[model samples]
Target: MMKYLWLGLIFSMAAFRVMAFPAQGGCKLAQQHQITGKVGRAIHNAAQAHVVVRANMLEASLSNAVQAGVLSYQQGHKQWLEVHSVRQQALAYKQGITSHELKQFDHKLDRVTLYLCRH
Candidate 1:
């Protein structure tokens, strides 16, 4: 019984570390909810709220990924550059964020977190 229990535990831990492009299997369902929930809430919040939230998420996620060895510093930095660009554009908009801009922000962020699962 102990042997079987140990094996199950090992497998479960390995399952979460997987970094698959377009995440698949059971992990997808779990990550989709956490990431999507934030996106949903951001949509209803203030205009700057969505942009700020997602920009921070991208920076933090990429930074963590680099530290975890899931992504190299160069890879993480490249994405951070994009995040900076999005934030800058949003701030420059004298007018409140538009629907298309919001979608763009979400779309870019979705790409960044695509492979990440709760770690």
Candidate 2:
């Protein structure tokens, strides 16, 4: 009777261990990090695109205001010009174009977008 009880206890412990084993491909930490990295980058890019579009629209409205004399000539116009330049840069970056024997402009665009999101 004593031997049978010991064997049953050992079998039960082994079964419990098997049932409690971790899932396949251990190291959940690394997988989680990778998931976070991808999500962060995607969020940053989306944010950059959204902000750039809003800024561009504002610049366009300012230009329209200048034509209609709703805003002073230089004030809103200057702001619009600046935003236009930034929008151009962003568009070029989005296009992934290279110029003047340099690396693609998209690289800088991606960096800027990421920076904006981080801030």
CA RMSD, predictions in order: 7.0, 22.8
TM-score of each: 0.58, 0.34
Per residue, candidate 1 scores C-alpha lDDT tens digits across 45-88 of 35556676657666776675676566778887887788888777
Give the per-residue lDDT digits (tens) of candidate 2, residues 5-49.
Answer: 999988876664443312321123233112211113222353345
For candidate 1, give the lDDT of residue 96.
57
Report clash pairs, candidate 2: none
lDDT of 2 at 24: 22
| Top model number, lDDT | 1
Alpha-carbon shift of residue 82 in model 2 (angstroms): 1.9
TM-score of model 2 vs. true structure: 0.34
